[model samples]
Target: MYRTWMRFLTPGPAHHRLGLVCLGVGLQHGALPTVGPRTLDHHVAVVISAGTGWYATPDGRRTPVTAPALLWLTPGVPHHYAPDPETGWDEAFVDFTGPATAPYTELGYIEPDRPVVPLTEAAAPRGVVARIARAARRDNPLLEVETAAAVHELLVTLRRARADLAPDGDPVLKALAHDACTPMTVADHAAKHGMTPAELRTAVRRGAGCSPKDYLLGIRLGRAKELLATTELPVAAVARRVGYDDPAYFSRLFTRRTGMPPVRFRAQQARAVPGGYGDRVPDPDDPPMIAGPRRP
Candidate 1:
């Protein structure tokens, strides 16, 4: 028999987020009679690291889910599920959102009509249990600092590993990096990777799970977001700094990817900061703008 443990985490409003969890596995069970009135941001997720459980809707729809399962829940769908008290269960839960959630929801990674998304595996819980245990030992105040980091790690890992995922261009992925300071054209990039346009598209989609162009755009947008939060760069400069020559085009693309234009993204973020997100102080010695995302 395998053993799994769980440690529950209650994050306050400031810390509400989705990802890895400090919740160690608890007792194992086949079913449960009660569950939570828990409500998360827009995306609610749960990972069944150990034990057996079922997710139930308000309408009494019960579905059994086992260990090593991952669940992503849609927003505003009231539902509840838990381990069978007789058999017991352990799980880590969290909430997530942003523009990405909508696309993911459409993909059926979660139940569009319902609130919960589930992924399961027999072995996942055993490993996740070990991870949570170790994290708890190293960090006492769960959901304090280390717990958040662990949760993020778990979320990243789980999202990257599911379904019969494709290869996702090992080369194309390698080509596109977070650096948006400068970048090469797709044509040139394809040649450098020794691929034709069609072949390049196929390879990238296979390995990375998205088209090459979309993949590059994602990296750029992610980097842009980092700058918006951490730097004093003006939004226009930030757009060019991230490779878009036209700030307007950059804004459109940014909005499409992040669900907020660069300027508004910066504004909303600045408001979230304690003393405001600092100030936009342009560097006098800033370097010239580059064309695209950086390559490896």
Candidate 2:
């Protein structure tokens, strides 16, 4: 006997601008039936939390799947799979597609070439699925955006849970982020870590899905933005804090990357405390209001 709970969604065009939209979600267990010897037009992440199954390609090659695994049924990929007849399986799946899928796939978060992924554990991804399911209720006005947000979280959670990643996460990426404000060149950073520049680039690409220089630049710029938006520091001081010695170069790079000069960005985004600024930026989604000084 098999049991299933599923919801299919059709979000409007405007919601697609959010960059990721959900098409469907499902949670199932028991002796499930075989899936396609066919192809799909969109992507599906079928997460198996329990039991065992076998996945096959159109070429008839089969890959065995145990508990805590993910099946990436990507667009136009011929796929076939089913659970053991007697034991069945417990599974959750999210079907999503949008322009953002291209970049995500390119970034190594969604692997088309490696369809069957072993997961260290499915709990984190399953929790995101449960959130999506809750948002799936009929006539829930926020359904589209809510589920879409959860899909992004789902992708990130799945990436982190990949069996290949160390349980504590990528040490090199962590170290690089820690030292991002030290004004080191990529080669210099590589030497500090006892690696050649080429080897460091490869490691960062594998762990973070970007070149080392790009990764460090992202960290430095993020910190610079936080300082600009929360403090009264001069642009030159902010630049120096984020590893750039030249204020002119920093302003030009910031403008090119963010489409605004630092002063303009500060004017628009500043959330100053009366007497202090925190090191971290608050989440824009639920930022605390900073009350200015009382009127005399």
Candidate 3:
């Protein structure tokens, strides 16, 4: 006989504004009946952890669903599926929806076009689902907020677990981020990697959901901010360290992006140190222990 446990939630409007909210969660196993040939109004991440199944898209093409796979059922999408009648499948699912989903989709964290996704492992995402299920208690006052926060974690975990992605991330994206502080044009960076500028653009867009130039600038400006706030370096020194040779140009760029000049931003964001600022972190609360003489 099949066994199933599930909880459906109705979070208030205020929780919806928190950017992501959980609608439901479930865990099931054994010979389950067929699901849908129907449509849903929200999204469901059905994680198949064991056994096998078959899924059909709106176009009527069916794909096999093996263990360690995910089925992304998005809003207004027609979906149909079922486990093998004899073996059945172990499945856990999380239903979620929010404005945050749009950006998550754009950033490649969610794939609507490809409904069935192979995962390298199902344990991590399943753990997140279990947490959501635990938080689904009827009388938990913090249930809505706790489960909603876990939804965000669940999405990120699923993205990282995709079978297509490398364990460390895309090689090209990793290399680009590694060299982000170098003073090189996108074309120069592309040439170094043996790619054309157009190809580099496509890779960055696919991996990061942004142009290559924007990606490098984000990294460079972030370093510039850190140097300005933590060190007593002059603006020009900060600029040079972050790859901009022309101080005037760096100032303008930084101000345009950060809405203030470097000095002003530093003034506002600088950390307060009990002792004078230095490379070593301040340990005001926990002083280093002194050694006592050893007993003879």
lDDT of each: 0.57, 0.93, 0.91
lDDT of 2: 0.93
For model 2, the stretches where C-alpha displacement exceeds 4 angstroms are 280-296
Instruction: Order the candidate numbers by TM-score, best to worst.
Output: 3, 2, 1
lDDT of 3: 0.91
Candidate 3 lDDT over 55-78, as tens digits, reads 998888989999899999999999
Candidate 1 vs 3: which has more TM-score: 3
C-alpha RMSD in Å of predicted model 2 compared with the true structure: 3.1
lDDT of 1 by residue, 40-123 (tens): 446555666566767876677887866656655556666677775667665555444444455544433444474443443424
Considering summed lDDT, which 10 consecutive residues are worst modelled in model 3? 272-281
After best superposition, candidate 2 residue 69: deviation in angstroms?
0.6
**TM-score for each prediction?**
0.42, 0.89, 0.90
From the highest lDDT down, the ranking of the candidates is 2, 3, 1
Q: For model 2, how does the per-residue alpha-carbon lDDT over 1-296 read when each residue is reduced to its tens digit? A: 89999999999999999999999999999999999898999999999999998999789999999989999999998999999989999999999999999999989999999989999999999999999999999989999999999999999999999999875558999999999999899999999999999999989987888999889989998899889888999999999999999999999999998999999999999976676567666799989676788999
CA RMSD, predictions in order? 12.0, 3.1, 4.2
